[model samples]
Target chain A: MEILLAIVIGAAFGAVLDRIGASNPTVIGKMLNLTSLKLMKTILLAIGTGSILMFGGQMLGLVDVGHMSVKTAYVGVFIGGLLLGAGWAVAGFCPGTGLVAAASGRKDALFFIAGGLLGAAAYMASFPWVESTGALQGVLGGKVTIGAVPGSGYDGLFSALPGDIAGLVMGAAFVVIAFALPERLNPRGERLARAH
Target chain B: MTLSWKSGGVLLGVVFFLAVLLVKPIGVSTQFVIFDGILWNAVDSAVVTQTAEGVTSSNAYLAKSDGKYAKAVANPLNYSFVFVIAMMLGAAVSVWARGGLDRAERTMPALWRANFGDGAGKRYLAAFIGGFVVLYGARLAGGCTSGHMMSGMMQTSISGYIFALGAFAAAIPTAMMLYKEG
Candidate 1:
């Protein structure tokens, strides 16, 4: 049941992403170019809709806030984000979406999967060394997510902003960024160029 | 709109109902551990260890990414991986039914054929880096882009929003440098 639900959701998610031209690297590139905000617009829409639902659900006592979230402020995340950006620019697919494209029969997607698996293996094999190295470990020495949130000066042992409020803040921020900001360049032909 | 959210929702509902009613929930990462675990076991049994203190660990850090759509598989009954394998196959069927599949050479640029991509060995390097980075971010942040950013956002996760902001912050710069208007 869980698996079925997951596939259905995943498929819909993939379809939506596909329809919006997310599968196309050019669309992403254009969004980056300061030329178009279509991608940003779509993302803002998704986040906006999602947060609204969450907030409503929380207030109505329909959703479990604790189970609905993950740990926060992971230092490794920052470094990982830096690395992910470099790869997205070069390879054009993240792990989940790469599979989506491959299923869509894009040959490059297959290559992406193979590389991903091998890469995963390689990282595991080298974890001990990676931990010792200055590149990643240096940035996050003994700082685990949720464990070390740099003393907010609040004395409670376990505390975080309520999930709903956080969601509202994030949702509002995206909406502001999407509409307030002008096209970095010109919005011309970005839809056609990137999404193919 | 060409497609109604209701239709999509119904399809998902049906899939979920059926999955829960008969099959296990859809998952994908488990299929990987079969290959990954075996490789780890082959490399050094020492890496796959069970602590007397009851702290279980694998050399393969996939243990970190045991998310809703992904499960932790230590051995046989790696049913989760099996489920992901099924999901991917299901995805293929869905795509094939739509008559939308193509070869990479037919679409992607041969940028590496020149000396530009020589720095990274074509698809090999690109894929390797992509997999490594996405998962690393996923694990570090306690979720993949899907679980952390996409799913998190969908469920109204503040962490997801943070991840998204972080993603754009990084993506905006890199997307500019590597891809020139083409």
Candidate 2:
């Protein structure tokens, strides 16, 4: 029943992504631009609200801290990041956002999703070689989260910092960006609103 | 001026949250799973059954420690991944409702025209390459940009931090090249 509810919630979430133009790759892609900070407001708002909900839930014990997950460090990720970012710049889409784009009637988005699926399939088909190449054998480890460490670390440790601190930092960063950015530029998912 | 009924930003956040609360918290790398699932389904017929250690009766897969892998295949109705699928569906519905569901000609950057040849082929090709890169990175960094920049940061994962660093670093060059002055 809960999972079913989750699906409903998930569907609603997707609907929102479509309405806001988040599913549109270009709209979301600009967030990564250094000069643009195009996504700063959306980023800040998400981080801010996300922080509040997450911490509030955890603080109230409505959530379990232990169940959260992260991955082991690997060079594959580094290489992938470069490729993914480059792709975003070129094509203006990510997996999730791409899905939304396709949903929103962008045939171009459909192409991206299909392409990703094909690429993924191709990788899997070649996995035996990719794996045997030890291409991804950098540091094999179990699922680990930031809180798992006794001491703080990574991304200024502030970004990696969880709960209120991270929220405050991300939120503050957004606040600064909000002040720093122009209102005329429009927010990330509001592309259509900004367009005409 | 007018907000559409499809509101995507809050939904992005909402799905991001549901991801953690339900199935696998944080990252989902839809391309990876679909791609991997297809392969595993083909190869051992046991890959999909392969469950994470210490988990029992998970809706995704169950690890028995009995060496049989998990008991079930991942459902399309769970969180994160499902959220992504739902997102696609939502977008489809929204676009249809808005009457913006038709193909249109794009005439923006020269790069768009040169690469896509002012046709559907270039656009789709670009998308395909984009997906490939993202999944590869997700598999490599142990997460996607979403997992890293979005969920990873939220969860405070070291890998997420490291993954994000790579994403940002790479993003600099890519953005400069693509979005550079006309």
Candidate 3:
């Protein structure tokens, strides 16, 4: 039953990713380069809306706090994120988008998948060394949330503040920014001329 | 016919929210690791061993979490892995429903052509390299954009916020360096 639900849910998520132009590397490039903000805006709005809904539902008892999965805070997480961003800018696809694009029949996506497999293999091979570096060690109380939420076992950095409220506030900010952002930060024509 | 960005964004949000509410958060990168483990296990039976204790991998990374990853590698049909496969199918379905790839999808993007040439080989190489870097970094970071940033922020995880900041900090400058022509 759960596996069936996973299929249904995963398909919906993929379809949405495609419809949002995330399956297109060009669109991703535009978002990162500020050539076009359509994809970026869409991504932000989605994140913001999801955050609001999840946090709000938790507040209303429609979502389970225990179900919320929080990743550990570690130095390597931040550093790895930096590296991932650089790759995202270069390739115009993250792991999810890459898979979606491949399924969408973008030939390059296949290559991306191959690359990802090799990369994962490399990581698996070097896991011991990476672990020895202590980058995996937890930081900021390991799995702490920004604000405390009742019933969640994890501690909050701000114990007095409610996590749901904090999430809602942050989500709202993303929505506002998504709406306020211009279609393109710098005109493509202007950048082209400057390049020459 | 594609949905407008506004509608797409809202719908995407709803999908993610429903997943979190009904099941679990949406994540994809960890499956890549599991896939690698599966391939390695097939090549060398020793990579993953099924003992009375349960599935265990020679690889420490997979053996961690009490061999949760090793178990997934052995089983291979669990929710998370199946979800990723379904995602690919869903994307193919979307394309089929849309009457197949439009001109933009069929060809290199205009922005890409403006900066990089129309060489398919170059694009493929770059894509592969990029994929390699992103996946490697994701594993190092413990998650990808989906798991760490999107889902994490939704759950208000502090690590998520930090990851986002770190990602954009590196991404913005890198984009500027690579794509001066827009």
Candidate 4:
């Protein structure tokens, strides 16, 4: 039963990823180049909306904080994040989007997937050595929230600010930004030429 | 109607909401880890036994006490594994419906050609290296952008917020240096 639901949801998620041009390396590269804001807008809005729904639900007692998985802060996570970003810029596909691209019949994306699997395997093989390095050691034991909302399963800097309120403000800001940005700019378009 | 970024973003948010309500939060990397476990278990049963014994490294899905691990060891068809397969199937269907299967198969995209020259081998190598590094880094970090940034941020986690800032801070500059227009 859960597998069936996953299939349905996964299908919708994959379709949305493709529809947003995430499966296209050109589109992804453009976003990375800062030549386009379309993908950024989409990501910001999605995260913003999700933040609102999640925190808002928590506030209303509709969502269970216990169920949501929270990642912990670590020195390694910060360094790893930078590396992941560089990889995204170079490869033009994150793990999820790479799957979508391969599914879309991109043979190159298949190579990327293979590489990713190998990478995962490598990490597992070196688990002992890597763990010994203290990179995966969590500073807060894996539960820390930005706002430190009381009763929420997180602790962080902004304890006074309600998490739901923070989410609302962030969501509103993202929505406004999404609205303000144009979808695309044509090189021949007068507005683009005038800016140059 | 063609799904624009605006509509797609809205739909993604809705799907995320429903996913949280119905199941656990959406994550993709753990599915890969689960794959790694299954592969290692098949190639060398000792690896599986060691993981189960907590002698090597502990994985939630490979632990003997975990029901999912039991089901997976019995037959590699746990929920996360199935979800990964379903995600691929979904993308296939979407591409087929949208008539994008052929066009999406290009080996050398314009961006790669512009930045790295038109060598297909070099481009593929770069892709492979990038893939390896990203996945390894994600494992080191305990999650990827989706697992940490999107889901964690939704939960108002400080780690997610910091990860996001770190990612963009590095990604943008790296991209600019590599692909800056002359």
Winner by DockQ between candidate 4 and candidate 2: 4
Number of the candidate with higher DockQ, 1 or 2 = 2
lDDT winner, 3 or 4: 3
What is the two-chain DockQ of model 2?
0.40
Q: In lDDT terms, which candidate is top?
A: 3
Docking class of 2: acceptable
Model 3: runs farther than 4 Å from truth? A189-196, B103-107
The residue pairs in collision within model 4 are A145-A155
Q: Write the per-residue lDDT of candidate 4 for residues B30-120, one digit (tens) a residue.
A: 6666677777767776654433533332443345234444345445565666766787888788878876655524685666776677677
- State residue B80's C-alpha deviation in candidate 1, in Å: 6.4
Please rank every candidate by TM-score, starting with the best: 3, 4, 2, 1
**Clashes per model (N, Cα, C within 3 A):** 16, 16, 0, 1
**DockQ-derived CAPRI band for the predicted complex in model 1:** acceptable
Q: What are the RMSD figures for all models against the true structure? A: 6.8, 6.3, 2.3, 3.7
Say which candidate scores most in TM-score.
3
User: lDDT tens string, model 1, A55-101?
Assistant: 45556665444334333444555565566556665666666566666
What would the C-alpha RMSD of candidate 2 be, to one decimal place? Answer: 6.3
Chain A TM-score compared with the true chain A, each model in order: 0.74, 0.68, 0.93, 0.84
Alpha-carbon deviation at A67 in model 4, angstroms: 2.5
DockQ of 3: 0.73
Candidate 3: Cα lDDT at B119: 88
